[model samples]
Target: MDNLTLVIALAAVAVAGILFFINRRPARQTAVETVSHRRYAGAHREQARPAADADPQTRFVETSKPKQYRLLNSSEQELYHRLCEAMPNMRVFTQVGVSQLALARGRQEAMRLSRMAGRGVDFVVCDADFSIVAAIELAWPTTGQEIDNAEDVKRVALQSLGIPMIVFRPNKLPDADTISREIADAILRRNRLEAERS
Candidate 1:
C-alpha cells in the first residue's frame, strides 16, 4: 500500500475505536444506574409494607363510652340524701366540683386549682340567692398524709374566700337535725366574721 493510504487507514481505525469505547461506556453506566434505582425502590416498598401476619381487624383503636354509675358510693349516697333532706330551703349540690365553687384569679392560681379539680366536696350548700354558703366533706376513718394535705389546702382556700367547710365522719352518722344545726351555725359564724371585717 502507499504511505499516505496506510496513514489514512490507521487514523480511521483509531477514530472508530474511540467512538466505540465512548458509546459502550455509557451503555454500561446506564445499566448500573437502572439496577441501583430498582434496588432502592424495592427497599422502600419493603419498608412501607405492613407485617406479613398483621390483621386489619386486630388493629388496636382506642375508644370510650359514657360512665354507667352514680358519682357517690352507697355510704356517700346516704349522707348526700340526708344533707339534701336537711337543707330543703338551701340548694344542696352533690359531688360539687371545686372549680365550680372557686375561681382562679391568676395563672399560678389556675394551675393550682387545676390540680385540685378532681378533688371535690361531697355536698355544697348554697343560699336562696344561689351564693355558696359552705362546702361539706364526708370524712372516712382512713388517715393518710395525702388526704390530710388535700383537706388542709381545701380548708384554707374555703376560709380565704369566707366560705365555711364542715367535715363530718361517716362512721358517726349524725342525725338530720344535728346536721342542719351545724350548717346553720357555720353560716351564722361566717356572716358574723364578714360583718366584723367590714
Candidate 2:
C-alpha cells in the first residue's frame, strides 16, 4: 500500500481498538457490578428469611382478637355502680379519654392533646344531652409514685381546659347525694365562668 493508505488503515485499526477497549471495559465492569448486586441481594434475602426448619409457633402471627380484660377492678366497679345510681339521668362512661372533654385550638395543641390519648379519667359524667359535666378519678388510698405523677398531669390538663376533676378515694366513698350536689354546683360554676368569658 501507499503511505497515505497505510496511514489510513493504521488509523482505522487504532480507532477500532480504542472503541473495542472502551466498550469492553464498561461491559466487564457492568458484569462485575451485576454479580456483586446479585450477591448482596441474596445475602439480604438470606438474612430476612426464617430458617427452613424453624418452628411454626416461633413465627410472629397477628391475631384477629387482642387480649381482653375488665377495664375496672372490684373497687372501681362498686364506685361506678354508685355513680350510675346517683345520676340516673346522666350518662357515666368508664375510662373516658381526656381529648373528648377538651378542645384543641391549633395543630400544636392538637399534637399535645394526642400525647394525652391513653391518659383517661376513670369515670366521666355527662348530662342527658351528652355534654360533659365532670370527670372523676378514683384515687386509691395507697397510690404509687408513678400513679401520683400521672394524676398530677391529668389534673393540670383538665384544669387548663376549665374542666372539673373530682378525685375520690375508695376508702372514703362519698354518698351519692353528696356527689350529685357537688356535680350540680360545679356545672353551675362552669356555666357562670363561661358566661363571663362571653
Best by TM-score: 1
Off by over 4 Å in 2: 1-68, 103-109, 142-147, 192-198
Model 2, span 1-198: residue lDDT tens:
599999999999999999999999999999999999999989986786777788987955556687768889888899998898888999998987787666433465556677688778899888899877778998875558887888888887776565678899888888889888878887886676557545
TM-scores of the models, in the order given: 0.57, 0.56
lDDT, model 2: 0.80
- The Cα local distance difference test for each model comes to 0.79, 0.80
Q: List clashing residue pairs in candidate 1.
A: none
Question: What is the TM-score (0 to 1) of candidate 2?
Answer: 0.56
Lowest summed lDDT window (length 10), candidate 1 = 104-113
Error (Å) of candidate 1 at residue 117 is: 3.1
In the order shown, the candidates' Cα RMSDs to the true structure are 20.9, 16.1
lDDT of 1: 0.79
